[model samples]
Target: MIIVSASDDNFVPGLLNLLYSTLFHNKDAEFYIIDAGLSNANIDLIVNFSNRNKIQSHILLADKSQLDRLPENPYWTSAMYARLLIPQLLPQHSRAIYIDADATVVSDLSELWTMPLDGNLLAGVLDGSVHQEELDHVGMGNDEYINSGVLVFDLALWREEKTAEQVVQYLLRNRELIFPDQSAINATVKGRVKFLDRRWNFFSWKYPEIPAITPTIIHYTGDNKPWKKRRAPLAAIYEAYRKLSGSDFPRPRDLPEFTKARRTVVGLFSLRPKYWKIVYYTARCRSKFTTPHIRQVMARASQLDQAHPRKP
Candidate 1:
């Protein structure tokens, strides 16, 4: 499996945690880290770590001249657009798994790597946080939108179809999109995407759930990132990986008590009606009403984990 992720200096901790978690779970995988303005010291750290561990790794520097064409936001850097260049970056590989730096893998990715694409150019989970209005704006149906966080890409197909070029053109034309790259990819390859089970790319808001299947990849979506917020949902899992990664980076200071309280109040009032469904789902998951079927599913997943314990 070839795992690709992009990050700048600001996200180095998250990137290291992602690398460690993925390596801990998978035995046969290589990594390609896209350099989007990482400092020279940090780049050496990653290269030295990979060399010390005898891991196959490559650091590809992105072309700033091309990436500058994509619109940027305060919330995300232009590095987010680097995934569109995967086919062009690695011409030797026929397929690759693109995961966001903010996510951590908890299960073996071999299944995801080898899953038949069924002639689709990309495979990813449906975005749970998207609204109907956003879908309409992107000219996609309710079910057509897929999260760009965790994607299984058919690189050869992308090259043949000129998908990267088309996606870049779409994004340049639609700069006002709420989610630039995600909406562009969905719009460009509407019928050509295969939706995977949600467990493949679970969002942080859906934490502590009794889902039919356990989440293999936990995505830290939204602003309350695990590295930045001590109270962020599923943060402990991320911390475990941080320690496992053997990173000596200083931990970020938690938000001040007053600031945290203020943000909570502000967040409450900012919630729109479209978010009520997520609130209800979260409430239901935490409720003491786990069905027998859900229990069985959890048991089976637990058994599988025990059978294939994570590497120390």
Candidate 2:
């Protein structure tokens, strides 16, 4: 009954809403958050927020020195890499479900916790943004390229495979790609991942066709986040749980493009310009360079396999 998620300052509010929705539906679940450089004030807010909602939560700080070796982007910080370190960090936990902060759980996770992985390293939904080309680039079948947003993992098995270390090595060799940890997971494990239902990581683009009954998990994929003013029911859903969480955190301000540009200009003085370059390089190159390193990581993976890979 363990649910895990990784977050930093940028997505702190989204993490709060996620916790609210998840704990509201599954009262008897253990929750953990990878503390990826969240402020003490924000951590205090999370503590008070969870306490007010009666949801028990554990915050695990990121080992920045370990995570710093991986590639990152402005779209995602080094905290995103923390998910890869779970098997090593939480060795005591046999299994856990990893959900993105941008996603919401509308169904009881206890049922999900009961679903067996059946000897797979992880189980996740396929990505909405993925295409045949992207799948080919990663040397995976179109259906095998999963969305890393929501995953059920067998941590002990992951540890035996040394997945976190292998992924870091793969990233070091590849150095230039988006979805760093995600791509690493796919490349290292290759075709071994089991596919979970898309409803578990339901994308907003499918909002029109979603059944009247609530989805298991609603993913706020792409740029149109629910934090600010948005037109869809997703926004309403997010707002509801946000209120349910009893969070009095300030509503973020929306800025026009001109104002955003001005703020960006001011921010540049205090920011390191190198991250923009790194993000640009990845976007421009895409996954055109993952082949060789991926092959190497695959070769390096443990050949000893587990028979009955059960979840906790």
Candidate 3:
């Protein structure tokens, strides 16, 4: 199987961690990363990751300027649209899987890879948030809408139907209304998508019950990304793989520079009890809030032993 993903420099760490988790549970595949101005250092890390793990990985060079001509959509960066070029670029591959960088594969991906497209151009999980909007946008029924987060594309069908071209043209016509490439994809391929189990692209925010045993892919579809926020549920799961993988370049907090600075200001001066206690303690100790204060406890015990000299 061939797995495809796209990311810009900002998402390199998350993307690497995503792949590390995937490689942990699956086998015999070539991974493709669609590069959107990834720095040399980051690219080297990714390249070394595949080499170290002995996995076949390729970094497909994407022309970032291509999307610059398209109408800007604030909801998502143009990097997200890079996947649209995959089928055409890698024409040798008959089928492919495209997962967002914000997601981790907690279970074996083989099941999703084997899911038959059944002549459909693509297969994906439903996006209820944009269901009505997508349906209304594309003039399709509510049931026809699917999220592009975790997509299983039938390359042959896509190439034959010129799905990418159609999606781009649709985006141009509906430029004002569409704010995401995902909505555009669904609108263009409305009737041709087969909806899969939600677990395939189980969004962390949408479903309150996340880390559900059934979810093969856990998507961090909200602002509380595991790396940025303090207490996001399922953060431990992401941290597990994050620690297992490299972390040379960590993702900054998911805030604008001004917003992040403002939060830091408040955190530094807030008089609310326990407001900065956790931050200060964690900074001094460098351990999780749940961890025992072993170092301090052991030091106190040592002092007591020295002062009370047992004669025995």
Judging by TM-score against the true structure, name the best candidate. Answer: 1
lDDT tens per residue, model 3, 148-266: 78999999888988889988887788777554577778777867788898889877654334323246788888676777763454565576666555445553454456875677678
Model 2 Cα lDDT, one tens digit per residue, 85-163: 7787688998999999888776678767878888888888877566555566567775677888899899988888777
lDDT score for candidate 1 against the true structure: 0.81
The prediction achieving the highest lDDT against the true structure is 1
Candidate 3 colliding pairs: none
Segments of candidate 2 deviating more than 4 angstroms: 131-133, 212-214, 250-312
lDDT of each: 0.81, 0.73, 0.73
Candidate order (TM-score): 1, 2, 3
Candidate 1 residue runs with Cα over 4 Å from true position: 259-312
Once model 1 is optimally superposed onto the true structure by TM-score, how far is the C-alpha of residue 179 displaced, in angstroms?
0.8
The better candidate by TM-score, 2 or 3, is 2
TM-score of candidate 2 against the unseen true structure: 0.77
Better of 1 and 3 by TM-score: 1
RMSD of each: 5.9, 15.4, 10.7
Candidate 3 displacement at residue 162 in angstroms: 1.1
